[model samples]
Target: MTGPFGATSTTDDVLAGVTLTGKRILVTGVSAGLGVETARVLAAHGATVVGAARDLDKAKAATEVVRAQAAQGGSLELVALDLANLASVRACADGLVAAGKSFDLVIANAGVMACPKSFTADGFETQFGTNHLGHFVLVNRIAKLFAPGSRLVNLASSGHRFSDVNLDDPNFEHTAYTEFGAYGRSKTANVLFAVEFDRRHKAGGVRATAVHPGGIQTELGRHMTPEVTQAMIESINVANSAGGAPAFAWKTIPQGAATSVWAGVVAAADAVGGRYCEDCHVAEIVDGEGLRGGVRPYALDAENAKALWAKSEEMVAEAF
Candidate 1:
């Protein structure tokens, strides 16, 4: 089924005429850009939104932006959540549970990109740890607190096209680390996480979705060097000059976040669990569109997803 909106659709467009009165939503990475915009739209629609960020000050700023844009100036709360640390993830989850609150929507929108090689508190590679495993642990820890009909949206990226999980040496213990490779592997993991989560929790009326928010200028690119940015711009320009690259496109923050918000609230997607989505639609199987926008084969493979889930369970066994 087609998504309720398209790549051009904004968060406001997604929430238009929609009412989220009394619903509780938790959006990570809500400090700026699409995350902030999403929180704004949700609050405007009457959802009680908890905007999670690593920086309390940034979260406060983001909440203020939401309030400024809200028609009713609905509930907006801020809390600290750092996906790089297992203890932090536990603390965040524990705090939420301590509040005696259950969430109808949990948007795992926080992520790191092609950062230099580093390790988390658990000694896992930075990208995989922060972008995938942290959220993995978070969702599992809080699975019990999800209200019926709850939706979990994992903010995946088309960058998964660059690579899949390097299961043999996920942390680069025996091999060299490349920034983009680590980012790609983490992105693939994000999709697999959603697939497996949906498989495990869908029976309880909890649905999971992985979304590629499309390209937008956000603080996400802050880590990119000038050379990297230039190369990216050159690639896009080349693609545009050649008719348009299949893997690359430009979107405003609102447009970029449409797919995520759509996945969260669209009734049509209730039955669309465990799939990769883009442009606010369930992506078509990519065959000829390898150069165009569509999910990569490995990222959407059920077996790979299940395997990754098992591997993640082992990697975080201590936490569980």
Candidate 2:
């Protein structure tokens, strides 16, 4: 469903006049980019935010502005997490559960973009492991802390259109690995994870949705050279032209994070539950080779989401 806001909306735009005095939110990847900005807006509006990062020092340095700008009852706290390693993921989840910390929202926003072929601390491919499996284990383990009316927003991308999850060879053991392809698989998992998680918990008033932040110039591109960045932009423009859509344009950090905040805090729960969102609205589903907008059908398929959930449990040797 379309909303009052669109691509140009900032986090503050969606959150205007909203008070979150008792809202407790957990945001991953708080060290930089959209994560920091998302936390900033939420906390600025009176929510208590717990920011998680792989490196506490980096997060500490990066989030000084968040602390400085927070108002109302807003506050920031940091937690150590390493999404590439299950041991660290479990420890973090266990610590939160042990502390009896409850959350009204959990944003799975940390992820690695296209990077050179590598493996995570686990045997899974780098992107698949760090971006998907890690959050899978961590979120599932800590879900007991999610009270009814809570929400989970996974940071997905339009890149899910690049490829669906290759469930059979999720680790790339039998498939040739390309940076974006693996990233695509992981992003798709982010969306599918939301679908399944929402299905599993929505009856109890918990819902999950995934959002694409749109293109932004951020540290997320640290692995890409200027030439590669240009090439990707050109490719996106070409596809947009084919679809008669507006050419690709980069959004500011605030604009990029608006959809996540909108979906997580402002939008009606039923509109986003178990769906994919972008541009601060529920995204339509599209098919074919086009990548200008909309989500792929398979990413929202109930059967596929269930299958991926089961396979994820098998790969991680844990059940939710």
Candidate 3:
């Protein structure tokens, strides 16, 4: 069912007539792009927003305008959080817990895209460690901070079409690593993480869902090279033709953020927890080569989710 919104819908559009008084939200990667817009809209609607970033100073400066536009009783604050560093994740979670803040929403919106081979301080692949494992450890450790009916919104991508999780060799220890392959595996992990997280915690009243926020030009693509860009475009065109699908489209920052804001605050989204959502609703599972839209069946595979959860726990060496 198509909702009342579309690709053109902005954060403000989805949040119209919505009052978020008494609600508290934590948005990671809020220093720029969609993250900043998401925080601004939520706070504008009366929600207390905690913006998390690697640089507290930069985050503060980036969000100064959002703070100025905050609704009465709404507020925005910055906290240090580097998803690539487990220590930073732990410290940030601990600080929030100490502050006695119970969150109504948690948006894991921070991520890196196609980049050179690298590893996090934890020695995990940079994309997987920062994008998936980082959020994995954060959510599990701070599980108690979410109030009943709270939503955990993970920002996944249609780029997940590039590959599924390589459980046996996720770090590319023996295999050749292409930039998009590593990035895709990390995104697929995001979807699976939400699936397993919801299965384990929904009984406690919290729900987790993953979202493909659509293709938007953002700083996240700063790492894209000319070769990678051309290859990506060619791949998408081939996929679209093979599947008889339309060409992919990009959204503005606000437009791209619509699904996240919808998933975070919409009751309809809570009802479909654990699902992969796109275009403001639960996405259809599709077959064939159209990497432009629809979710891969593997992304929502229950067994995959469970296995990923186990592996993630082992990697972090900490169980919550």
Candidate 4:
């Protein structure tokens, strides 16, 4: 069921009148931007949020508002997780499983966008490793922590419009690499992860979905030079204005995080499970060139998703 919301709705707007008094959520990347706002708003609605970040100190400083504004019984705690390092990822997930806390939601929100080519501590491509594989291991390792009716929201991006995953040369080993190409691959993986995860767990009432939070002004673009950023912005605006649509505009952080909140707690489970969403509603499948929005069929392919899952397990040397 689509709701009375659009690209501009903020997290609070989507969550209005909904109380999360006893809900426990695990949100990755609480150190800044959408992550912080998502945690703050959820806590204000009385949900206990366990925030994960690479820099625990930065996360604590940034999440002060989450603590101060929390509704009664709502709280926030910081956990150490460097998504680039598999050892750290496993340790964090293991610790959480040992703690025995059940989570109503897990938002895989932390990611590095379009950074220079680099390898993770585990030797995988950086963007794919951190944004997709890191969360892959962490989430599956703690799979037992998912409460019945739980949800997983993977923060994908419109940048997925750039390209699909290059499983053959994920590290750019034999293929040339462009920053956006790498980013696109990772974002696509985020969607496929949701598709496969939702299929695997929905029977047990645990749903998974992918969301594009809309373009927002945030530190996620730190890697791009000002000129490149401006160029990308202009390109997006050009695309946005097609078909008489409004020119592109950066969403406020709250607005950018809204779809995640909506999918996690507000949308009907059957409506969003295994689907892609944006602007607080399920998105349609898009095709052809000069495209403005919507998901690509390849991203939603069940067989490809399963294949990625198998490849991911083989790469990480762990089975979920």
Write one digit per residue (lDDT tens) for candidate 4, span 1-320. 33699998999899989999999999999999999999999999999999999999899999999999999699999999999999999999999999999999999999999999999999998999999999999999999899999999999988888888877778889989889999999999999999999999999999999999998889899999989988987886787677466777789999999999999999999999999999999998986443367888888899989988998998899999
Give me candidate 1's TM-score against the actual structure. Answer: 0.92
Where does candidate 4 stray beyond 4 Å?
none
lDDT of 1 by residue, 1-320 (tens): 23357878887777777888889999999888888888988888888999889998867865687887665546788888899998899899889888879999999999988888999999899999999989998888888889988989999987787688988889999977898889889999999899988988999999998999987889898889889877866765564456554445579988998888888887364655888888888876663222346778888788999889878888888433
Q: What range of 10 consecutive residues in model 2 has the weakest lDDT sum?
A: 1-10
Which has the greatest lDDT?
2
Q: Which segments of model 3 are wrong by more than 4 Å?
A: none
Per residue, candidate 2 scores C-alpha lDDT tens digits across 4-47 of 89999999888988998999999999999999999999999999
- Candidate RMSDs in Å, in order, are 2.5, 1.2, 1.7, 1.2
- All candidates: TM-score: 0.92, 0.98, 0.96, 0.98
Candidate 1: regions farther than 4 A off: 1-4, 71-73, 233-249, 287-291, 318-320
Model 4 worst lDDT window (10 residues): 287-296
For candidate 3, write residues 1-320 as lDDT tens digits: 22587667888888888999899999999988889999999999999999999977877888987898899678998888999999999999889888887999999999999889999999999999999999999888888899998989999999888899999998899989988899999999999999998988899889999998887888999998778777777888788777777776668999999999988887474655999888787888986554677899999999999999989988999976
Screening candidate 1 with a backbone cut-off below 3 angstroms (N, C-alpha, C), the clashing residue pairs are: 246-291, 246-292
What is candidate 4's CA lDDT for residue 259?
Answer: 97
